[model samples]
Target chain A: MLELQDISVIFHPGTIHEKVALSHINFRIEEGDFITIIGSNGAGKSTLFQTISGAIAPYQGHIFLHQQDITSLKEHKRSRFIGRLFQDPLKGTAPSMTIAENLALAGCQGHYFSLKPILAKQRQQMYEALKELNLGLEERMDTKVGVLSGGQRQALSLLMATYAKPQLLLLDEHTAALDPQTASKVLELTDKIVKKNQMTTLMITHNMQDALTYGQKIMIMKEGQIIDVINSERKKDLTVEQLIHLYSSKTNDYNDRILL
Target chain B: MLNQVVVIGALELGSIFAIMSLGLYISYKVLNLPDLTVDGSFTLGCAVSAVMTLSGHPVIGLILAFISGLLAGVVTGVLTTKLKIASLLAGILTMTGLYSVNLKIMNDSPHISLFDCSTVFTPLSVFGEYGVLLFIGVVVIVVTLCLHYFLKTQFGLALRACGDNEDMVKASSIDVDIMKMIGLSLANGLVSLSGAIYAQHQAFSDSQSGTGMMVIGLASIIIGMAFIKKDQMAYQLLAVIVGSIIYRGILTIALQIGIPSTDLKLLSAILVVVALILTKVKMRRKEVC
Candidate 1:
């Protein structure tokens, strides 16, 4: 389980450009919880995820993963237990490196690096993993990742994120850049991988349908706070229309553009 | 006879400089760090080697030269990574500081002559004219093979990743600072070794010998890249060595064609500019295609 106690992230605390990105966000995530986060732009959703990943330090808070205080851990150190996929397809992978090399790097996550060669056995394992996606990436193990399409790259990113079997997985709008069909395919793959590993996943998505279609729990964020969290039982019975009705009533903002 | 002499001399010098170019390849191309410390480290290598050889320990001289270069690189790496100084500025600062350091190493002398000293090449004296060539050729080959294998390892992949995408590297749980330090240290160490070898070959080490070394190394790398398919890492390194030889050939031919010695630096500057422009034009054409 992960816990955040009085997490507050303030950018430029005293200057004129001072902005409260996250204000005293207190939340807890149980083990094996698949939570999908939905919010408008600048609603502190990304900030919340960043705070948890140690990319951004909270002004006043303590974060714990399995009762181990990770509030002051550096990003690279925290990466041992945390896997992340960025929204930009280019962000998660090294373009100039080959597919097999990237997978090799992923496999060595949280481990000491040696001068040993990437063995054939390791490459074979990676090929099998890529074959599961059915993307034909297994045939192009030596090809540079720069030449891959956005969807293919994101698929590889997802595989790399889950390859090391971290304690938590964070996907920040990972499929937002792909076309609708590709996005759905990636989403399906995400569900398959998460369920297979029984990973504790927190996915941020703008699509209300996706927010509803996947994940066991749904948390709505607004103005740097978790305003509403719909649990599994109620979430199963809820529809997109009812969710929208609740959102409109809670914020009193009837703009469809804001929710979408 | 004159042409043959020019060609042989060029080959000898080219093989020596090829080592330095390989060092630049690591810092500039692999780490993507613009390290100006190369100039100072080159001189430091010469100075240390020359003094050690003068003290009757030629082999120890070469080893010390490499160690000194590594120390210099570590200073630059610390300045850039830990202190957050701009990489270029950090290199420049180290280069400037090394001026005095090199002078001190030579006992405040601007140059040292090893005319009667026993160098690594001395054992091969029976071969006469081909001795230096054979010695340098073997060194370059061993260095190339070692580097080729090193770059294929896991540490090498992480080092390359640091240059390609730092965020991805950090996300993968590799320490970026340590990688940078290791890269810089390795680069400068190779550069100094080249300098040490050159001093032993020429039987002299001048403090000013490394003034335009960075330009020469860069020009060699650029020239080599132009002649080879650069998609593969091994081929790219080989191309850099070939480029160094070709660059030396061109320089020797220019000198033979009656170019004054004083204008050599100007020619080096112009050559770098042309090489850079050629690379840019090729990239633009690729984009258009």
Candidate 2:
């Protein structure tokens, strides 16, 4: 449902310190496509996500969603259809606010000038949704999000990002900072939510096994280009060893985090 | 050691100042903006109220004062958000420019005496000596309730989140710039309303009356919040009002001890500095525990 044509992002252009973050990138995200991106540092994966989400305007090219140009839409306006989660759990939720309030904010998305208070129906919906996370958060909806563990916060972030049911969801290393157990737990939650809602999602990760395990397609990036995209058929029989071999064969470089 | 009359007078003035503190509570506490526009907007309220009261429309004067205050906040908001001016500098620029605007509003006069004019309090004389106090007390309560309700609304939730975390607010599909502008406008509007009430209470409006006003409001907020440990909004607002009264009470004691009125501004600055140091020390101690 989303397409990027010849997108490029150059930082400090024309200066001696100029560096190209993305170059002549082209990609199409089909409806309900769960795309997992694997890239080394400076591979332009995050930059590509930022460009599509409107955080940074691409130096060149056009972005179309559902065949309509939204290249010039402001970041906040574009957020109506694009839900984003960052690596930092703290970045997604307000620490000082309660869990229910955070959920309320996410549910009220796209109503820019609304003065309506949280309705009883919304509170009930939030309670039901939190219960589904199985985090025992429903009973403590009044508790501030700050005191929650990193895993809980990320799970909550996932729910909030998908609560309003955006047209596209962007997950940028959302579980990388958590403990391995918590990371896997959050990943499972992510999988369940995306499947239940059928959300079109793009998740960035350095973990090779995760890259091979989840999502319908694995997009491999090097330098500033999408070098390969393994479809669902190819992904079914792909192993970590084979994926690593496929990556190093293209770039002749091996990174430790990606292997992990 | 103070008598009932002096205590009542302090409360009347305290109630007036509480209105301004409520404004400061939004800008400084909720929105996390240091809005120096408080100084300029407060005086703008007095100037507008004075001109309006002189024209036999004390009620309209109050309404206009609040509107003027909102406009002052808008200017500061525009400078900080659109023009990329720092919040402190934006407030300073607005306050400095408002000096001239305040003068023009007062018809080039530095002060206006409302001694013989009718005020909102004049019609309540039949309630005897405590008429003004009773009226101001009810107004403060009404304002506190309205403000509390507003803060609980979904829009207020977004505003608070904007202050708490701007990125999250943006990710939630809310515009942070527009929220900040609306917040500052509301904050300064309440401050101007306070100033209008102050002019009516004191029977005069002076251009220099707003001097050190921002410090005074900060001191009241800091002192009040120090006593209120709960994160609940209602208790926090009550602390502001009580802190204002306590600040006024301390000033009364200072006067009774024969401290010169000229030294009061110095005292206000010192009080704010002391309160800040205390709160910092308290926070550090908590972290240690």
Task: Give the Cα lDDT of each candidate.
Answer: 0.91, 0.91
List where candidate 2 sits over 4 angstroms from the true fold: none
Report the number of the highest-TM-score candidate: 2
Per-model TM-score, in order, reads 0.98, 0.99
Among all windows of 10 consecutive residues in model 1 chain B, the one with the lowest summed lDDT is B1-10
Q: How well does candidate 1 score on lDDT at residue B70?
A: 93
Candidate 1 Cα errors over 4 Å, as ranges: A252-260
Error of 1 at B73 (Å): 1.1
List DockQ for all candidates.
0.77, 0.80
Candidate 2 residue B274 C-alpha distance from true site, Å:
1.2
Model 1 lDDT, residue A126, Cα: 100
| True-vs-predicted CA distance for residue B53, candidate 1, Å | 0.7
Q: Docking category for candidate 1?
A: medium
Tens-digit lDDT string for candidate 2 (A1-260): 99999999999999999999999989999999999998888899999988998989989999999999999999999998999999998899999889988898899877756777788899999999999899999999989999999989999998999999999999999999899999998999989989999999999998888887889999988888999999999999988999999988887777676667
Q: What is the per-residue lDDT of model 2 for residues B156-217, given as tens digits with 9 covering 90 to 100? A: 88888989988888776898888899999999999999999999888899999798889989
In candidate 1, how many Å is residue A217 off? 0.8
